[model samples]
Target: MRVMHVLKTVSKAAPTSLHRSASKTSTRGRKSPVQRATAGAITITHADRVVYPGESITKGDVAAYYQRVMTSLLPNVVKRPLSVIRCPEGARNTCFFQKHPMGGLHHVGTIELKEEKGSLATYMYAKNASSILELVQFGAMEFHVWSTRIDRLETTDRVVFDLDPSPRVTWERIVAAARLLKVQLDELELTSFVRTSGGKGLHVVLPVNPACSWDLVKDFSHAIATRMATGQPQEFVDTASKTKRAGKIYVDYLRNTRGATSIANYSLRTRKNAPVATPLRWEELSKIEGGDAFTIRSLPRRLSRLRKDPWENIDSVKQTLSAAMKKLEVGA
Candidate 1:
């Protein structure tokens, strides 16, 4: 977690030129991959390295999966810095979190930032497919990206309502809770997209116009989450206390703030099932039974028919938190 803090601090202190640098560079800088090369390509050693046992999945296969879904998932990951869960051995063995800039990966960009405490550190951010492949070469199995890009560090592009349930809760109850929260958000005139959390929950993501600061968005998120818990006492909660959950779902709104990450859509998990974080239509929520319904093995086939990613048009729509804040302030 200390290293992750270094990157988080660096993310905030990133120079304004970093934004322009992020833009002027090629979105798909084409070149071959090298282990320590400066750019263009990457090499995946331990191609057969297994992360999930009994599944026959390999590090190389996972890289290929990311390549396959790059067109669908790149928009969400390309510009953002990742907090990686790397398992140099394998998923079942000891794994650690990474936020510090790696030294020997091609196309992987770094920003050396000064901390408020008066110290300097470097952080890493990805700009293209090769950047991801480079990380994979290091045995990264789970990738958690921040809410905004390195260029617009303070402005969140999306507000996330990460929904979690107690062990006693069922899918129907989860669906009921998600719909209830969406109705409230709808009244605020916000359009939200949903994703299977790739774990034990659902995440309602709202792409917004990036005008508000992290503080403003965090306050709004906190207020709305609290309202859902207090307003619908029987259906939802906002506390971290499990005993107080009372079988209600948690409307986790903290993902709206800075230095926090939500698993990227189409990303994979290290869990036994190799479950995937998947985007979905608003109408598909009720039909989902479990997060593992879509696993790594089944995803390749699913991709063949998905002409467009459910989130492909997300960046095209820009929303602001001002009105949503106003509506929440009025107790609407």
Candidate 2:
């Protein structure tokens, strides 16, 4: 919708309280509109239903959060193929992960994607406010995006290094691992950004030239992970083997592969308190306590107070894997 609408809602916002307006009162023999909240053209049904029971956060509250963050969220997700987690009843209830459209929602549009089996599949994407709100209406809790935009499906424009920490690993070590990766990336003359995965890890992302193939991108990422694990065997592991992950951080490079996805920035996680996958400045990492430190209830305040976006320069950054690739190949 309008930018003003987004600004107004966020400026005068809080987690939706439990009170209902008089207009929302039900009439005899008539369906009540209390359960739905409408913006300009989009409507979120079950607005009063509790999605996060622990926080008493309602569907409307989630919708409001999306609206408030849409300016920031849309850039990372719009026009990208998505795999969403839908919690139909609520976050505490049954949830299913979906990549292709199953024929219910109209606002969330679908694109034909070529699958590995040489078959065309319909993948979902949201271009604007209505489509995003439609997903909130569809009970979508988390949004994951592929590395490439739909326009350039085979050409990846981004690289993501997911630092998946073992349960025994402390948050401090996780932070340290990200900084170390940053140092390595810096040495290669590549600029990178960082964000919380909203789970147990951090994602170091870099915007790359879209000319690179998925194979090249994935190989480069694997090289970085391998080099890190080799240099610091005591703190890092490169493989996905669960048994080897104990007391270390797993540098998950697989998300750079074709069709792989990472949680989009500003997206909510399907967790208690509705934690957000938040982006932070490198300096802010040491100050932040955990990956799930910022929830839907607290993120708006943080956003309002921030002087500049942590990833403000991400879109302007232009780099390729060319130089980095040669270094890894020689090192190998």
Candidate 3:
């Protein structure tokens, strides 16, 4: 469809109140006739690519999807620097797009140029390509949005150890790893927040001072993972190889990069379009079914009444890397 038509469609879809929380915004750019034809209900902003099973989304469609998500799933993360990328037409191996680090792939360490740009629309697509690729590998087929703002940096001094069990792994094992993580973090007096990955695993996020570099964070994560593996050999897998991780948990420390972004708490999953990663009270861990936490489709509604965000006061909490590391050594 044409891009201009898509712009008009998105304008109609724009939320009446730009001030309304999560409401849509105005479309204030000139467009070509091509943009007018294939407009959709949503507009894609800061996206690298849009993947369709048998067709490609026109520029208009891209813009529409951007607006849709901004109006729908992205208000919280939107405050961060933003970009978008669209997937090409007739693409089959979504996994191939995801694993590749070049172009729009999302494996990690992919870069896109925004300042040296052509059209603003084109730049948005280029910047978000890599992130879109990663989300697609996780069963996402739509436009993937991204933010590059350094201000999004929340924890710098704190260390996070992500415990992810392989698919088909038992929930009991996942919980056991979580229990152990709580003990470990508590002993160090490093407050932590635990949330489901929206898939099979759990992410235990800790807020820390931002003084340390990524290398230190990596070291701390590795040390904790090693300790946890030694203490619970059967339940936690410490190997760096995929083949050796069978019947065990994997400790993922890659989320410590400077621009790294996790799917936000209470964010939506575009594939199932369901709510995923709902925040939980630590007490609810044992009560709810393993996968009952939340998904994309249900999160916005839930956030209306949520009084506290898990990471709300993360910045104010004072804890040093030295103290945290020492606590780890004593298993305090």
Off by over 4 Å in 2: 1-33
Alpha carbon deviation, residue 37, candidate 2 (Å): 1.3
- The residue pairs in collision within model 1 are 32-41, 33-41, 33-42, 34-41, 209-319
Query: For model 2, what is the error of residue 246's alpha carbon versus the real structure, in angstroms, after optimal superposition?
Result: 1.2
RMSD of each: 9.4, 7.2, 10.9
Model 1: residue 295 alpha-carbon error in angstroms: 1.4
Give the runs in model 3 whose Cα sits over 4 Å from its true position.
1-158, 257-261, 270-275, 330-332
lDDT of 3: 0.48
TM-score of each: 0.84, 0.90, 0.59
Worst 10 residues of 1 by lDDT: 12-21
Higher-TM-score candidate of 2 and 3: 2
What lDDT does each candidate get? 0.73, 0.84, 0.48
Clashes of 1: 5
TM value for model 2: 0.90
Q: Is candidate 2 or candidate 3 better by lDDT?
A: 2
Best by lDDT: 2
